[model samples]
Target chain A: MTQLREPLSLISECGLPAALEVMGERWSFLILRAAFNGFVHFEDFSSELGIARNILSNRLARLVDHGVLARERCEHDKRKVEYRMTDKGRELLPAILALRDWGLRHSDSAAPNLVLVDARDGKPIAPITIRAHDDRVLEWGDLAWAEPGDVATAPAEACAEEA
Target chain B: MTQLREPLSLISECGLPAALEVMGERWSFLILRAAFNGFVHFEDFSSELGIARNILSNRLARLVDHGVLARERCEHDKRKVEYRMTDKGRELLPAILALRDWGLRHSDSAAPNLVLVDARDGKPIAPITIRAHDDRVLEWGDLAWAEPGDVATAPAEACAEEA
Candidate 1:
């Protein structure tokens, strides 16, 4: 977790930009997403994400380096390697799901439907929805200008005070 | 919307970094989230988000200039300006929700919980979650494999890949 910084440059959260700056790249989330998808081996991640071997190697190293994922050699295949999420990486699932849901809503969909739920259990662990102050679900433009609830604690300078 | 590129780099859909690049930034999502949370004035945004005047001014100008938000002189206060989400801006609700959802998950009551619901009646929109094919909620490491999934089509390679 990142430490909250004192308000600087008009933005209350200093960690916001750093979070965005580090996370704002393109492939990091998907790679993390795939991790949740259960492709633990180097070859499997490559096959599932369809990332280049070179790129996979780089991202894997970065994730491990960042302590988001842990790496170990595959026992079955001595030459093979396996990766798993650290608490830090596990924490990213919410963000990943949020992005998937957003993509499904704003853009065209591919059948895989980023989420896979238990048909039998009818339960999902990662369907992270945003709700209202009273605990009701919330949406865009729902705020009435009187109360800006559930606003993202990110950089406000780039965005307007619409919240 | 960005075109689906070959999985040349990590920023492809499978990666959270990619989503961050597209949606996560200093002010971009904050502007949207604030709108969703009910903020509407330049000063209010400056005050609440604590954004620097220059940066806030720039973000407001860009969003308005890009038609994401419309700047209408306050109906009553000519000196006052009200920023409203354009339909296009409204369309960004999902993305904003997505990131907010992400934040709620990684937080520990240090942050408030979030959800999406109806504005008129305050009904739940459903909590957000993410998972993998087995209907199992995925942890980031579950998919960390050496084999990059189908990233052959990515337009560019991830920087870390080169490093």
Candidate 2:
């Protein structure tokens, strides 16, 4: 963890750079948001997001190419195509929610007119969080990078020594 | 909630568009990641991220202008400067970590060489999750949008009726 404090050239080793490479742009994320909100048809995405045809087309194609979305023939209308979210795309929910929550809390826009609520109870959902395996909340200082092979050989003692 | 299923202009009403306006680009996020990894000096960011000096300067200035980072003179060396994370920047940890976790899991790259561990127990942290206020793990289907003013007038019956 702290080892990264030095210029070790390990930045590329993390998955972040790769993830950003795929969905780092604004419209891409907005398109993903639309997908999560149940947008599938090209026209739906274009009209609802109010995104330009070329931009929406590019982002959707990129998402499908990357496997985040799958292109499928609409069962109800074989002549029509739909962009469906793959499992990989669905799994990005937490990340999207985290950013949405951050934006809701910190943006200069007028207070959000809507809130994400739990369907069962109707209460607004709690903010997205990083929790330990045992369900304890964690802070930035509570994190460290495990040494190589340490996770397999001695997970418990890995960050202990550093701490 | 499900009302978004129709063509509504509410997409811009969510905080997501605002958030994307601020930090939706790849380099901005990468720079933030480097800062979280304890990089303070411009040279450290440029050398470690292999970012161009002009690009680094531009990103740093934008982050500062947005109040995500504060530029300060290094106390120990007046001529030297440090870019420190503001509270706003620190709050993005969950979003960043969530994206990092997604990348680690879905990217076509090789398995991650390092794991993020909890400093207290040295165990890998759990995946970021969306939890209900009552601590229940929630799926995407469990979420709905609260009607405007419903959060204040009838929080419990809002999504319940929709459900």
Candidate 3:
């Protein structure tokens, strides 16, 4: 796992933009969603997503280049290739799930068809949330941008007052 | 807060795709990111995002139509309309934040400009994670898909063993 490295400034960074640059296309997110559900071969992705062969090929290549997916030649067939999700790719589960959760709640569709379960307990996972270190769920009103230096541990009141 | 609703089947659901249909455009995600940072007016979004007027206008309208944004006349200036996030729009914050977090960890860029902080405690919020009901962080290996009826509360082993 990568270590947390919070930026000193929050006004101008393009973290989300950067991620979007890699995976922003309409088909890319869908492809990742399929990958998470154990879709690996090109045919499987294309059939499941109904994506064009050429576009699917291009998107898969881009995903591989970005290190989100690994393209490996099929051992049984030299001409065939399989795309596997990397650990980095797996980390995207929450983002996709978040989008799915938002859709289920707000979309006009009354019935959804997917369920993400905890293999440990067989219970369904919850929508991803922005939580404090102590694990309290946060909402939009609870968030504010702050400079790295402004986050001083010396006085909790100092920070609370800024709110 | 919405309750968790497990899907009956994962293969046939359009949850993620439906969400993408509303927000799949390249610039929609950026607009939502800016909204989270408190940008509301058309000019503010256009200037800050450097988006073309026609394209920005279209996106704003589409977002409004999708009920993600509420366009209301400014109280003081009837000629000016302010785009405010609806509850649906606010729900997308976690998704955007998840993309930002992934970008921060895996993007080629070494510096991220924005940091999401909890105003209540002045502490930075941790990366969003898919947690179980008992609060254990899960990875791809720790998850499995099952039918709604397959999930039982009696014993977790029944589920783990299925894995």
Per-residue lDDT for B1-163 in model 1, tens only? 3433435433234434333434544566666556645689988887766668998888788777656788999878899999988875665554454444444444443533233335554443433334332223344334322223332222232222211
Candidates 1 and 2 compared by DockQ, better number: 2
lDDT of 2 at B13: 70
Question: Which digits, one per residue and each the tens of the lDDT, describe model 3 over residues A1-163?
Answer: 1222323233758577668877887589988988887888998887777778999999999999889999999999988888999988988888988888887778677654546778877887655777775566788899877766666363454334222
Candidate 1 lDDT tens digits, A1-163: 2432324332223223344433444456666766766668887777666768997888788778767789999787799888988876766666565665444444443433233333333322323444343333344556332122643433343133212
> Which residue runs does candidate 3 get wrong by more than 4 Å?
A1-12, A154-163, B1-14, B111-114, B154-163
Position A37, candidate 2: lDDT: 79
Candidate 3 lDDT score at position A163: 28
TM-score of 3: 0.86
Q: What is the docking quality class of candidate 1? A: incorrect
For residues B1-163, what per-residue lDDT tens digits would candidate 3 score against the true structure? 1222323244748488678878988589988877777788999888778778999999999999999999999989888988999988998988888888888778667554445678887877766887775556777788877676666463464335222
User: Which candidate gets the maximum TM-score versus the true structure?
Assistant: 3
**Which rank order by lDDT, best down to worst?**
2, 3, 1
Name the lDDT value of residue A76 in candidate 1: 77
Ten residues in a row with the worst lDDT in model 2 chain A?
Answer: A1-10
> Model 1, retained fraction of real contacts?
0.17
